[model samples]
Target chain A: MSSEIDIKYVADLARLDLSAEQAEKLQQELGRVVEYIAELGEVDVTGVEPTAHAAQLTNVWRQDEAKSSFPREVMLANAPGIVHGDLIKVPRVLPSEEE
Target chain B: MDLKKSTIHALSRNLKDGVFSSEELCREYLKNIDNRDSEIGAFLEIDRENMLNAAKAADIRRQNGQALGDFDGIPIAVKDNICVRGERCSCASKLLEPVKSPYDATAVELLKKQGFIPFGRLNMDEFAMGSSCENSAFKQTKNPLDTSRVPGGSSGGSAACIAADFAPAALGSDTGGSIRQPAAFCGVVGVKPTYGRVSRYGLVAFASSLDQIGPLCNDAEDAGIILDAISGFDPHDSTTLPDPAGGYADAARKGAASGSLTGLKFGLPKEYFSGGLSDAVAKVMDETIAKIKALGGEIVEVSLPHTKYAVAVYYIIATAEASANLARFDGIRYGSRQEANGLVDTYYKSRGAGFGDEVKRRILLGTYVLSSGYYDAYYLRAQRVRTLISRDFEEAFKQCDLLLTPVTPQVAFKFNEKSDSLQMYLSDIFTIALNLSGHCGISIPAGIDEATKMPVAAQLMAPALGEKVMLEAAAAFMK
Candidate 1:
């Protein structure tokens, strides 16, 4: 079973802020899922390479030429905040001390 | 003319023969949606005026003797996860409630190239996380066949629309049986082409390696037509294979016309027919096998030994990819946003509020599995086992042209029937392996479950890019 601290750590890594209640609830639920998935340990996978993709695809490259993209106005249409009629504005990135 | 019951090919023939204009067909479908959609809740958004205008354009083109193709005027529903320009591409989540797509997905673009109208955005499980459409932050899409039960999901609304006759056909993405399971439940034909057979450029990412876009239609021939229209290599999606020859529709037609499966060999995996299958579904399977034998197809017992481990590997790999793919929705770029004192807090609050319980649980599981120290034991191990599971298919196909199995252990359950997450995950046991192996699979309605009277379906899985033979067999089975 996942401890509360473990669940908190996972939530933090996922960038999800869970309340005490949510974390506690998730701990139990995730514990069950993990336990069920633990059955994979029984399979002996000696020297077998992992299959990351269903279809084998190597490096795919496209021409590095400028082409049409979504217009500036259209691209930023869904932005929560916009500045200077183009730039997407977000909250401060750096800490107060860095600023 | 019962437009709802008619197939896309039949409707196209009617349009060509001047039985009715494309505008008339659109109005009939619109009226059907108007009268029935409120109860079925299959559509998330429908633009009647836009649809009619497109239909009028189709009519004008026909009058000018420049019809695009057979499907020129066909109205099709698109699963919400697929982008349709200028329409709400919510994926049935509050996070994308305010977001509208700026461009059509590659599949939608292809459909438009064939003069097909993108009629409406259908609902799905938020980010395609849940087995049932109940995870939608919006309304729950009930089974059109039985309003009290679920429409099997995350492509629930896609399947529901076809079943309810709201559209002649629809497009749905399958990561872990999202298309086939719902198609089985709704008693329609659904196909999940081999991974990379269709471009995933515009599909909202959900397990990138496993995700595929395919069609849900009235029959195997319609599936062939839609697949031909939407499939081809795209520079946009690097994973897509170069366009194969365009004979899938012809293959289906030939198979249906042949009236015999004389030389076909079908494998029945003993693992699939074993325990945990409900008696009702098993009885249906026996009858289906008998029917297949009568059709002159030979049945052979084959073994996919690692079948039991599919669900475990699928959840790990799918969730791990989902955690990374979904990280892009951090509030600043698009979709619904929540403000906070700092950027970190902004991400936390927005994601926490935006994601539903099922999505949150998966993110947490994904994060836990992929985190440092546990990566080798969990994610890497699951990948290796995924390799073994895939190899199982590779070996099984050598013995037969295709394999037949039940799509789900049983028919669609009542709403909230299996609330436990593991139980819900286990329902996908048979279907997930195909996604993991990167093979194509189709689900066609086999018969009705005598006990519940819900739809029961049988699935046929083929080797990678084996769509031609698979569709032929499916068309034969349909006949």
Candidate 2:
């Protein structure tokens, strides 16, 4: 019912560096898109069951088996930046709350 | 032996008859890429040595009287997202620029086995995200038909290369009309086969359920030939269907002979013809339906009332999948990593710098949808809408053998016209419904829109695993 959205909050969530100009522009566009989406609320879906896939497939899977993987050297050779023992180094992170 | 302007079907016939050697055909297309790729920006990488070597082997097989599969010598350009051993399979993104495929995608293996020489990897939108090829990190591919405009993307390079006569046929993955939309924009034939009809083992995943690898070629018959070579059940791809009917070329040939749409029903979804469709496109669609009717077919109006929600539903599902799929691309695994004080910074910096803006947008959107507190409301609800969209098609197919619609609302828009990303996303509206339904579809250049002189595509969609029927209809239309 309300057409208000926090432009800066959404942009921050998206990791986009929106300038004042872009934020204003996006505010309008995003509002329209969201409004259009909200229109789906008008459809009465009381009795309908949610469908996850279009095709009727269940437990479609391949058996787990040992298969050859690319050689460690070849695999690491394609890495953008690699270090000792075929390991690729990157920035470390703080543990999450669950961790 | 030059494959310029030659279809895969024609080249296969010539090769079988010994009209030219495989090596000769491979060399000519390689030379064409060398001569024109600078301006056209088609190929991301050309494997000259391996291609010629493969072509030579095909020649030796011919000399030894060893039977080879159809199109033994014809060369094909593969979209960079599909893997080729030791070739840079970048997916047109800087994040994956330094990576080379350790193994071949199953489709590439099948293509090699069939005696078709590998052309090279063509450009695409970064991570196959954009509608126009402009998003490719390497370079923008100019439309071969009209150099000033974009070749439709994220398969723009594939379509442009074929249109420019660089490669007779090409492989492209469609998720939200990546293959068909570009094909229409560039005036080529592109098919998005039924899900599981072709294996997706080596294709860089964008949206797993929606992504399907298919052919982009100069004509529908050539597309069928390429599909025949690449499609089959693969143990590596759990989604692939186990069936002998994957031989689309033979099915198409047989279908053309005996199959007629004489009594078949076709639905033209009312929503597809509504607002935002250009007059030029509308006129061409009318003419195409007239042609189909002239061929003793019937057309009927149908309702896909959920059509307007397709773009939104597609973005939600596809981006959510993309968010999950692209998590594998973190710098630690195989891509460019930036150093930060800690792991969180590493992820933030690596992805922020490595990924393009559009990709970041989708990733963020996806992350939001799948995040805690929002999952049930956004992700769950979108799934239900997706079901409704698919059900609409299922109900419609009960009446119509195929559904016809415009591939895009308009012809190829100029690079400047789509500055707003939402506008660009709207281009996939016509194609996304087919993807959501998990059905087989193709876009054949119906005719040029008389108003703007740009090409318009007639989309043909059939039930799941109905590539044979779709191709049959397309070939019939071509004839």
Candidate 3:
């Protein structure tokens, strides 16, 4: 797991621009967290079912359909910066964005 | 008529009886907040105009004999993560800087319908991510009891505001102790209802499975009233239990005088006291146990063998779920969008710039755990351990009516004490197990630690939907 993780790789995947300082700090922190989690390697789970939630719950979902939504103006009014009519615009995506 | 130190139940009763007006309560609390919030940083935003209008409307309803709910004319505070219509719900993160909720969260709607005049959003750890409120991107919420220490968090603001008497009652979400832990720290009562008991609709998702909205307040009875008002099955959240809603407030009020610890078997998990606990905490807890025993409660030592794995298991599952839940926040929908010419840049710039450090760390860890090669080894294994954790509780409950544990190992720490991520994670050890077990948990101020003079919380846990029994036990402790 420690092939000296490429900062650019994670940054690209996360859509973040890491200042060299922040990257250095994150690289250490992330590496430590991953290594600590790797300690879970010692636990043995041969046949246990993976429980998604603690509750003995299943098939909890709302029907798919349009329900109540907030007023359009109120929703759009909150945009720090917005566009004409229906869209809230933003900057174009960069090519090096994560997959 | 100081609203800061009063209970919601008291304030509401007074308002109904004309002992005081709703407008007066609102004005008093708003003034208190205005006076103190700047230094304590407990509030994210306070809407003076909206708050006044709501209070005035509540007053009119009262005059017309049209009080909406028991909480009408009461000022309530909410954690930042819960949505309030047309109001900014930042979740204590810069990512949602200017983000406003188009609709109110179900809990918020319930409060409004009950005639609760919403005051303002409280601060919390960014995206409900940390144990100490320090992780909030905007500002840190300090403990009202001791300013140097943290207000237990990610509901720190909720707890602190209530503790400082800025709000009579506040709503907080508990995912691995967010509500209860802070309640303990701030010397208030915090309840995390049984999983599926409360609707999660409109709550900003944290760890979806662990997250449940509950109340933090001055007394268990008030917590009960708030819980009764906001709880029940919601079509918006299918995870809500199908059981009928009952009056938790009535249970609390009735139990206050009659509830006895007599014949109640309290489960004491050996794991909770083994090590890592402070001496002062252990002493206070044992003394409290003695007090309960004197009151006729029986203590039985029980073992949750899988307790050791709870922290490890929780992080994997919570972070994995969080990774998925937070994915929707990528700039295109409601928040800031970082710009680039292509699609990738947009996603990258928005998330990269939008999310804070702690959030990024979780996303990265979540992605890694759920990544292809590690999915079976990490994520799958964590789930299996989660099952074992739940089993431990099930087994313990068979011998005891309720389980007792410390809310956290120590009192609230200094803001900078937990710079290391692992250290911060460890602080959640006692609280996370319940989240994994999915039981109802509540924290009440046990007493102050003699040395540090900070509050130590006594946690009470009951079997699923055993909120009545839980309240009974907490009421006994308070008495």
Candidate 4:
């Protein structure tokens, strides 16, 4: 029902950093897309069972047994960030209580 | 020796007759790529040693009487979105530019099992996001037919690659007409199977529910060859249809041999032809319909009242799924990373730097729709409209076996022609509804449009799991 997009808040949720200029440009662009899609409101969807996918999805079952997997070295070879031997390392999650 | 003037059926016969070894065929294709691909810009990487080695092995198998099948020595170009072990599956985005897949996609694996060589990572829209191939971060792929125009996208390079004869056939994924539109633009055959017909085990997810991998080839029978090899259920993909996959190749051949459409009823959806179709494409459609009628086909009129809402509904669902699927490409993963001081900043900075402008826009819109206070209106409402869209198809199919429509509203347009994002989104209006309904559809060349003098094409749609009939109809027309 709303056409305005809060680019900053949405970008935060999306984990994407955007500058003021980019956000302003996106404001106008996304606003138009939002307006266009707003036409879907014209359709009466009451009592309509939402079709998530066209085909019915059933759970694929398998035996509870371990299978041979890719080697740790092969898996670790592609890690882009810092890795401690076989593990990938990330920046500190918690911050120091410095003023 | 000419790759452009060839087909899989002809080349397979030649290979079996000892006209040339698989290695020689491989070299001819490689030679063509080397000489012509620089201008076409279809391939992201060629892997000369790997392709040649595989081609030689196929030759050795044939010589030793251990050949896998008639298609033993043929090669297929792969869209970068489909994983090929030890090859870069970049999806033409900088984020995953350096990452090499540790496994082959289910479709690629099926191709490999039949002694078919999979080579070259074809270009595409970043994460299969754009309508024009221009969104690719690495390089722009031009229409092989017209250097100034786009080849269509998400699967642009997949279509252009086959059109230019860089490969005998190529694998392309269609999430909202990526494969079919580009195939139409490049003047070739492209198909999107019923949603559950092909396994998606290793395809990089774009919009999981909407995505289906299909083949781009010179003719309909070649599409059947690839489809026969790659389809059926796979445990790796839970959504795969539980059915046996084969007989497609023979069906196509039989259709072509019969050369008649006497008993078949084709639907002309009145909504599909009403708006936005270029005059040239409309003229081609008129001629195509006349040809079909001449060939003993029965044409009937049907109405899909919800056709106008397909584009709007598709973007909501597709973007919502993409926003979730692409979240795993954080700094710590196997792709490019832009590390910052803190963990949150790292996530923000890495994603911002890695994604292109179009990708960022989709992510933002997706996040907004799924955000608090908007889920029911945008995401949920769109899904309900999707049901209406499917119901429209369901009602139309009751009157006819297959639907004939224009694949695109216009022929391939010049690069940067649709600068506005919404305008680009509208380009796939006729094609997107089929994906939402989870039906099988194909685009086959009609003729050169008088306006652009570039290739224009027609689309044929069959019921869900109705590929046998659909490919037959396409093959009948191509004959």
**Minimal lDDT window, size 10, model 1 chain B:** B242-251
- lDDT, each prediction: 0.91, 0.81, 0.84, 0.91
**In model 4, where do residues sit more than 4 Å from their true spots?**
A97-99
Two-chain DockQ for each candidate model: 0.79, 0.38, 0.50, 0.84
Q: What does candidate 1's lDDT look like per residue over A11-46, in tens digits?
A: 889999788898888888888889889889899999
Top candidate when judged by lDDT against the true structure: 4
Q: Tens digits of per-residue lDDT for model 2 on B113-203?
A: 8877666889999999999998888788988766778998899988998888888888999999999999999888999988888999999
Give the distance in Å from residue B198's predicted Cα in candidate 3 to where it truly belongs. 1.3
Better of 1 and 2 by DockQ: 1
Could you give candidate 3's per-residue lDDT for residues A15-52 as a string of tens digits?
Answer: 66566787788778877766766666776777777788
Which digits, one per residue and each the tens of the lDDT, describe model 3 over residues B1-479? Answer: 65655877777778878987888888888788778877788998988899889999989998999989667888888889998887888898888878877888888898888888766889999999988888888887888888889998889999999988898999999988999999988999999999988889989998999999999998878888888888889988878888887678777776677656898999999999999999878988988899889889999999999887888888888888888888887777677777666666667777878788888888777766777677887898888888888988999999999999999999888879889998889889999989888889999899888888998999999999999888877876786
> In candidate 3, how many clashes are counted?
9
Candidate 4 clashing pairs, residues 3+ apart or interchain: none
- List candidate 3 segments past 4 Å from native: A1-8, A61-74, A78-84, A90-99
Over B1-479, each residue of candidate 4 has an lDDT whose tens digit, in order, gives 76774788999999999999989999999888888899999998989899989989999999999999999989888999999999988899998988999999999999999999999999999999988799999999999999899999989999899888888899999999999999999999999999989999889999998999999999889999999999999978888988777788888898899877778899999999996899889999999899889888999999999999999999999999999999898867688888799889989998999999999999888888899999999999999999999999999999999999999999999998999999999999989999999999999999888767898899999999888888888888889
- Candidate 2: fraction of native contacts reproduced: 0.40
Higher-scoring candidate on TM-score, 2 or 4:
4
Each candidate's interface RMSD, rounded to one decimal?
1.2, 3.1, 2.6, 0.9
For candidate 3, state the interface root-mean-square deviation in angstroms to 1 decimal: 2.6
Candidate 3: lDDT of B126?
A: 92
